[model samples]
Target: MSYKDGYKWRQKSKQGFKTKREAKEYGHVIVKELDKTALLTKDTELKDLTFKEFADMFLEIKKGHVTHNTLTMYRHAVDAYSSINNIKLSNIKPLHIQNVVNKMVSSPTTINSYYKVVSRIFYIAINPYKIISDNPCTGVRLPRVERKNMIHTISDEDLNKFAKYMREKYPQAYYFLQIARYTGMRLSEVYGLTWNDIDLKNRKISVNKQLQYVKGVITFEKTKTANSVRILPIPPILEKILIEYQTHELEFEYDLVLNPYKKNGVKCQINTYLKQFGENLSAHNLRHTYATKLLANGLDVKTVSALLGDTPAMVMKTYLHYSDEMKAAASNAVANIFS
Candidate 1:
């Protein structure tokens, strides 16, 4: 069991106790040990810290462990819970925390995200300081939410219409869209593409890194996952397009294929251009559409998983759920085998 504000700690016995009574007795012994060791008792042995004070210290400690983006998000989450920030660290009850959570005007997911930061702050207050015991976020009820993907599958008719419209009205965005549709690359992965990574001879791209634009600085960061660092085989149509696009003479930043415009600049431009073809169309939507079509056409989930730099479970849950053909196939497979 984890102690409140105590490093989110877990204490478990390796071997199973022979009887329920034995287990209960052992647990009682551990509870006594925790009472002596843990700083959660109402006793005034140490100074009571404010939630805000402990949160600041925890965030500073977390800087080296998480990405700058993640750290920034956590900071924002903490700021969102400012109503209870001044509460005594040990005095925070579940009801007090729940009331603060209920006050958030954001979605349930966003509220939960903020609550995690608050919960962690409480956790750290228990350890090294012994200020509190038991997390206040436990048993908090969150509203049900349907997840909306930034990436949406475009209908085949819309896809064709967009292709024609983009080519005629926005050639630069069209090329970017084509590359994304053909490769199923994430926005950052597409931006990070270079001539060196594009193997024309092998017809595969070495997706080892991605473009990270942080604080006006451009850097090559590791791929989102180890699976994201695999080779992406280029189709003949895409290879032809890339060959022609490479010939465009433009000053390169970090040898990026889409030159002149940097990652953020190009991303904004591309999204702006997509508005004419489809309302709220994004570069990410093209990738989702690509994965949807692949799953619809009988492509195995495992193969699709690797192609999209996602796990099989994720591929099935996110992309395959949209494919009626896949669902039909699953039904037919069970019927045919059993009957």
Candidate 2:
């Protein structure tokens, strides 16, 4: 390994690492011998390659870290930020990326997605590639995204109306919506349900795995978060639905709640139903709806978070949008205390 001015350490001297710890140890030694001050900073090799070239290498390295869907999204960010495609990974500054982001008039959420992916690209360009010393993405800022948190959730009344409509209009896949509405499961998690995962005798549901469609094949992925793998009581409504649903013949995956439909197919059907009724809903909205209802009804953030497969902090940040009545109740509580 050699440490040049811009290229901090080039492990090209050694073909590859035999073990993770050994490689990391060798890297730590290089850091001490070279900069000896701060952690891995951007280095000069960045100037040598175009962003496209760097991306090819960066994405290859990324394959081991991210999921296929995540990698697909990274690819999309590359495509969306067309202006940065030809820039040199090293010469590219934060301002250049910030300018490109400024021009892409889109939702804050969309802008954030683009910004994060680009940031990772620059991060790759920095340490391992040693192409640039400073991560340009660090100095860059995307437009602020406003969370329409309260309006985003479907009210309990609306959920009931929609669930009833779905049950009558689309019987086979109806429970999927009900599960998402009541339990706050992701579309994939809803699809992942097998009869084996449910315990009607005990009125409990175990959410340990998620079913997703990756590359057109039905895949079983681990739940998004460790918090996501929870056991929740079967709500009275869900209990009634599941008991009826249990009678359906799910020959292949006998225990799955949604045996008849794939993930996308279920989504398409739900969206179609929503369109028919002029309802604007998403799969995540159902989860959010469930979470919001729980929080709005005085359930603690921690409990709601577990049910929704998210952190309590995350639940408070994203789910708790109190209604006018709830806000008034808060005011009344303070007034009563003061009086």
lDDT per residue as tens, model 1, 266-289: 567667756766787876778888
Instruction: Give the per-residue lDDT digits (tens) of candidate 2, residues 1-339.
Output: 555544454543444889988888887777665563233334446456787777777778767665567778888788777787788765688788878888887788988997888788877666565556678888677788787645466656766777787778776557788887777787777778888888888988888877766666666767776788899888887898888876775565545667634557668777765554345766666776676677678786677777887887786666445545567788999999999
lDDT of 2 at 126: 66
Q: Tell me the TM-score of each prediction against the true structure.
A: 0.74, 0.75
Question: For model 2, which pairs clash?
Answer: 42-132, 42-133, 43-132, 43-133, 45-131, 46-131, 194-255, 194-256, 195-255, 195-256
TM for candidate 1 is 0.74
